[model samples]
Target: MAVTIFLLIVAAGAILFIYQTFLRDKWIRQKPFPAQHEAILSCNLPIYPALGEDQQHRLKQLILLFLTRKQFYGCAGLEITDEIRITIAGQACLLLLNKGWQTYPKLLSVLVYPSAFRAERDQMQDNGTVAIARHDLLGESWSNGKVILSWDDVEKGVSDFGDGHNVVLHEFAHQLDGLSGSTNGAPPLRSNSYQSWARVFTENFEDLRHRSQRGLATVMDQYGTTNPAEFFAVATEAFFEQPWQLQKARPELFAELQAYYRLDPREWQRSTEND
Candidate 1:
């Protein structure tokens, strides 16, 4: 057992060396966001416009880290340009804007598709039926250094930010949740907040599930009711996009999210409106 463990560690070190020395440069190249990207910074991304000066700078630094650390791969004959990568990275990093940029320390790769991609999902039924099904996915996050997204949907997400649907934010939110060893809605919390986070999340999740089942209007997407993980991601979208609506419709859930994300979009919106 000791010999086997030693060999495994040696193999892991060799793989890391090869990846850093050869495979990484051949696959992805990192570059700073140049001045030209600034036009789209204000054009396609209206969310950044509402942020305060400090927040905007912090978000930019976060984007730079994502660009440098994460590998961007293009699928379906697509070319992964700096523009596409930065735009996607910027939006994904927006989720961490209030939470500190270092929140995404585990992410390493970002795979981008030209459009909606398909994946095989395992489905089990109560009647003893089990099947593998194909799912059309916009984005996905993995604990082991991978996040996948559809580039077209990413553009659409930025274009339609106010509509409360952003695949990038949704998937990155899953990445945060994955930090706790599982993507069951709760991420790694400070020592004092874990129990309360779980309790509030569970209660609100049930409430949202009930509301969804009853056909009631909800501030968060009904897709959230699919699972606790989805609930967190979908709620994140609504929190950033339609903060006032979320606060008015589900004040408790909104408060929980506000505490988690550490930024109040309602305040940003009010300041933007006044300006």
Candidate 2:
């Protein structure tokens, strides 16, 4: 009798999990995306118009899923609104449109501030004494189920997507990098392609660092020179924002990103240019 009860409890738990995940996802799919939200996406995210119909549909679906799963919190007296949620969701989902993940599974909450916020951290001084240091951050991604962003920077990044300085893209790319268990520059690759990704990214990372050391102005962001993980994030920003410049300057790096993302921003941009 006890064994049968245990089995029933396990089955019930499994059923509930399925209902929360897959069944609710199906139910959400049937619901019409709000026209107001559509207007927000159309206005805030310029790339939305460039997306093909199927991609646009998929993007909206992904944004819906993201909004459903993740909790958004406003800090610094900022009120969380549909515009803020939809705008952020639109850009974040843009990265996942072709990728397997619809929502950032590891992420549970998004904390937004009105503007760049000061963060404090413990740092070891040269004398072996730990000191508290404060630095202003526009956006940051954490491995512990949270992403923090400045609303001001988010709007800036979304409005000028071609600037190649999107905080959303940069931080979300870190989330993708973390999906593989390592927050290193590399994310999951399809069918043993990590070798090529590693080679191409390593070479480009080194080149960027070298160029930055000489104070050279390059299409790649100088901030990427900080580390490999940062390099990958900035590369993702450039890949989507200035695809033409990135492709022209570093075809191999662009190709790796194109293969991993399974989309060609260059083609999208070309069509948009003609339009």
Candidate 3:
């Protein structure tokens, strides 16, 4: 009887795990995303047109999951509309297209403001002094599952897809980096690729820092030199917005991102170059 009871307990535990991981996701996928959301994606997101049919379908599913799972709040007396929700969801979901169908498990709410917002931050001075400072920001992501954004910047990013400065993508990338239990620029990696990821990221990060210090023109934004976490976020913006340039300027770094994202935005860009 003891052995039978032990076996029954193990079986029940296995069932629960399977349901949480697989069955729940399957159920979410089965639900339909609203038809109006499709129009929003097609109109606002330039990358939507470059995706293949299968990829588009997958992206739609991811967007649906994101919209369903995450809540959006308009701040500074701005009213949240379907356009705001759909636009943000579409871009945020694009990052997960090939990475996984899993919606951002850590992110639960998005706070949006009318324009650039001021944030009060505590700063440490060179003389070992602490000072409070106020700075303007376009977006920020927190480890506690909250993201703040300037709707104005978000609109600008979607409208100017080639600029390589996407506030939404940049902040979301930080969330991805935090998945590894810290936001040190490196996200969780497959066991087989962790060593390669570390080496490539470190080398590229150092090179960027050196270039910034020397005042050299860099293909990547100099803001990436801020830290490893910022590097990953800025690199993500370049990866999606200026794929061809990034691939040409830093093939190895691009390759590392390609391997991690499992999608080739450069190829997508090439295919649509004539359009």
Candidate 4:
């Protein structure tokens, strides 16, 4: 009886330890972020003014989420300021405004560099050998819960959102796509919508590939023609940048993206412009 009582005490202690640890971590993550961080707003994008009062408040909340939940560090002594944090988090949360942003689960860390970063990739040999090569990247995403980006490109991406090239959106889109256990362009989809997404995306992807092969000037980015996965990322950049153009050029593809992202920036632009 004494042994059993001692065992229960041990179990209770273990449970309490775990609970305290979890609570501590959660409390730390919920800490409110400061309003002014030098880096966060350093490179403000022109599009920021278009956000309404409520949207602005939501953006502020997201900045705190990013600061508390993600790990960010500066390279070469580049200090991360509140503005930079807010800027990146605002754009990332833009995609989630109309939908459940939390759908992008499993992502845990974001690493920022002062500029383009270098990484090594291992090449496979025909005889089951591996060769390593160094490569430079503006941004990269890993399935193991990490994202790397260049600060220069991050600012450029925000400013050039209308141009359909954003590193943050591109990488985060990959994260969302990989949630279903693969990095292919196809992420988890509602059962009823998969058929349409597959059909429209495949048809458009193939068409883009064919046009690029023929050296035809395509509406979507030529980089998207590289692969279905890339096509999705590239298209996402374009969708956020030039929504009307995408809608006009590829209505079906635009519709799929609209359904997926749930917020139509084109409409936002129209409403804002009219005001």
What is the Å distance of residue 91 in model 4 from its true position? Answer: 1.4
252: Cα error in model 2, Å:
0.9
Higher-scoring candidate on TM-score, 1 or 2: 2
What residue pairs clash in candidate 3, if any at all? none
Runs in model 4 lying further than 4 Å from the true structure? 1-43, 101-103, 125-129
How far off is model 4, as Cα RMSD? Answer: 4.6
Residues 1-275, candidate 1: write the lDDT tens digits.
99999999999999999778555543432434467766667776776788889887777767766676778899887899877877887888787887754637788888889999999988997888998989999989888888999999999988877788999889999998998889999888788887877887788889888998999987788999899999999999999889999899878778888888887988777877888
C-alpha local distance difference test of each model:
0.83, 0.92, 0.90, 0.76
Q: Evaluate model 3: give its TM-score.
A: 0.92
| Model 2: lDDT to the true structure | 0.92
Question: Using lDDT as the measure, which candidate wins?
Answer: 2
- Which run of 10 residues does model 2 get worst, by summed lDDT? 96-105
What residue pairs are clashing in model 4?
37-82, 39-81, 39-84, 40-81, 40-82, 40-83, 40-84, 41-83, 41-84, 164-237
TM-score for all models, in order of appearance:
0.84, 0.94, 0.92, 0.81
- Quote the positional error of residue 216 for candidate 3 in Å: 1.8
**For model 2, how many clashes?**
0
Candidate 1 vs. true structure, TM-score: 0.84
lDDT tens per residue, model 2, 115-157: 9999999999999999999999999999999999999999999
Best by TM-score: 2
